[model samples]
Target chain A: MEQHMSEIVTAAFIVIGDEILSGRTKDKNIGHIADILTSVGVDLKEVRIVSDDEDAIIDAVNALRARYTYVFTSGGIGPTHDDITADSISKAFDLPCEHDVAAIELLRDYYKGRDIEFNEARQRMARMPKGATHIANPISIAPGFRIGNVHVMAGVPSIFRAMLDNVLPTLETGAKLISTTTPCPFGEGIISTPLGQIQKDNPEAIIGSYPKLAESGNFMTDIVVRARSEEVLERTTGAVRALVARLLTEQDTGQ
Target chain B: MEQHMSEIVTAAFIVIGDEILSGRTKDKNIGHIADILTSVGVDLKEVRIVSDDEDAIIDAVNALRARYTYVFTSGGIGPTHDDITADSISKAFDLPCEHDVAAIELLRDYYKGRDIEFNEARQRMARMPKGATHIANPISIAPGFRIGNVHVMAGVPSIFRAMLDNVLPTLETGAKLISTTTPCPFGEGIISTPLGQIQKDNPEAIIGSYPKLAESGNFMTDIVVRARSEEVLERTTGAVRALVARLLTEQDTGQ
Candidate 1:
């Protein structure tokens, strides 16, 4: 229902962790989430990495949920004291956070044969906002919950990926974007003006220029064009290729 | 002036690029910036990665600049159509963006003997918010600028690093946080209760539990304690280590 007839589906990502902000952990989840969203034709509009503070979590969740089609959050859902994402999400939605009967039953059964005890701390993982649906975690028995437009998942990369795999199939996706990248040996300085013209002319396609440093430290620009329609993508890339060819000819002929 | 007598200088980082959001480029700048900020005693409170759009850039810059002591931005300063960060920052601060005389001079001199032309597009790199001071880029002659507390830098990792090096010493810094980590053999479920107690006892320290996936797919937790005072850090880490030891003993006794 979030997606209408339009070919645009957008999502925002929230990374909640003190370890990431403290420089103790390098985030591997953002790129994985971006790649997964892109694969499903979801445009990742913005990403915010906030520390594991309750106020910060609540503020981000509320703000992003109202803006994007879906807001995905990772980290701070564990049994540890610092894990406050679930509670914060509940507070953000004005829902009563309590133990979910199904989650408690699942965790109890999961730990029945295990050596670890089903203690109070472990039970904390079962708590969720009322009216929330479970996003099953294949790697871990404790599930991530989906309340409103926000999908809360575990911080562990493997667990995040597993939860996303389960959640992606259910969300509305846009038309897959068609893209082409043309590599130009010239610097961005040489191609930027014409590239801007191409972008202005082809408003349907999203044109971007990325500069990379070669092994020899010379600048090389890659022109990437993306569109929902194959015809538009082809036309835009053709114009870009023609421009690059003309620039190369001028360089070679000393024009 | 921003630090005053407080020992808590904070910053927010904004990453401006579409390549990063499209999954075509995995961001190397966030972690590098986080590490650099931590080393300089600035707590990196938040990080937002937005696409190369004018409104997105302006919003992120304005919101973060108001909240944090410093706002550092990377990307969208190159000589390309997609490079709109400089203009966005100017608009965010309501400053008139004009060509910086020193930047134009430096770029012109740098391109004097070079093969690349110092065209209008190349000169676009010299534009900055009025009254902004340059943040030197040693690798590339084009400079990043610091307007008020916001520092704008390039997206290329090397160039970003060089610009940050030039900017870091000029900012106000906080007291360095002292930290210690203890590896826990038990899962977070086993350690969470006592870890919570340890955290409650040490109100001054920031305690965090991170879960890692071992080669055998089992969860391993690392208990980290951080504080501005070395004494508090030591005391908190000692309590965490003792809790781990007690849990290990309980497991061995099967009690």
Candidate 2:
């Protein structure tokens, strides 16, 4: 596998369903995709959860696909009357869409061994946009599809996740990640100034401060530092360590 | 609590962070809010994850807060340079934002017990928009604020979650939930026609079909039915169950 340089590879996720919009179903695809992208060094940037509205879907797809390197969509691909992802994507990209021969073949093969019927409803799963590639679904025969930069998968957590794992390895990957965190008992304000200075001093490393409220009713902050290269990250971490120690002492003696 | 008999109580979530846009962090707050809102009968209709850019934040805030009954935002309330939620909210609502006396008092009380300095950096947490009420943060002293209908919470999962729980009970809830699902071995297309009929027959119920690719490499679908009233939900579920049985028989015998 070839690795891209230290540049960041960004991705956006679009989740479609009236069930999620109505708050009837809690979406599980975002977290799963986030973790998977993180592990593979692909940054899972923005996520949009929209209803099965065609206008909303088309707008989000066009916007995100233009901004991010890759866009992944889950849900709205079923055989139901509301599964309008195929038509929406085609409309978004201005491509003709219809039931594809390969997808139908896959569905037929899977249903041949099962006690299920290969009916018109089942045939609905075979619909694909013109010139799209099918994403293999090891769990189900209704395969996900990838058109352009958008990878459309199922809404069911199990099926969506499996399809994600299959599709991720094929994408361009950045360098392995290294991260470290230091807890500061002081509030975010005390650390903000020095944190800015540290970032200014070490431009190569990516530094983030997360203010956390502990269960013990105490406010604490976590300063997370990440980098693609180990040496650069270590240098930045050293600077942060020194700054934290000095700040802690200054904070202690009322100086 | 007062119960409203509206058709739906809709909400939108705005997530503000450069980290999320850069893909450095996978957001957990959206899912947390989705689950909480669902349980409380608020329909979380849309979610927008935007970069910490001020214009983007303001634009999203204006658009979503106007359309939805409620808007909840997470992230950009820290002490760092990027912590700009309070300022943005002020701009969006055209309110003069400054450090609130009550928030300062809370911070003073919170930090008095800790061995850290209550310096300018920590003091940033006290800022709030004019006419905004503080949302309790049991996890940290840096309280989130509610301006108009927009509830601003910390981005950290634990803190955001704690703040949301505190605010949920105070909102006017619509109705408790009732839901049921029927598993169908056929694909979504076969079920779409009957699903439409079921939905039409039960206009009070929200019927949805989720396509699942089974682990046995077979396609299966879940037809979910939900309603605000248990009586209606049960009726819809019975109709769905009967429809599934009839459809399966019809497909099996090639009718």
Best by DockQ: 1
lDDT of 1 at A163: 95
List DockQ for all candidates.
Answer: 0.65, 0.45
- The collision pairs in model 2 are A79-B188, A79-B189, A121-B189, A121-B190, A189-B121, A189-B122, A213-B139
Candidate 1 overall lDDT versus native: 0.89
- Residues A133-246, model 2: lDDT tens digits: 999988766889999999999888988988998898789977866688887775566778888889888888878887665656545677788889989899999988887888
Docking class of 1: medium
Candidate closest to the true structure, highest lDDT: 1
Give one digit per residue, the lDDT tens place, for model 1 in B75-142: 99988888899899999999999999999999988887575568899999999999999999988779
* Inter-residue clash pairs, candidate 1: none
Candidate maximizing TM-score:
1
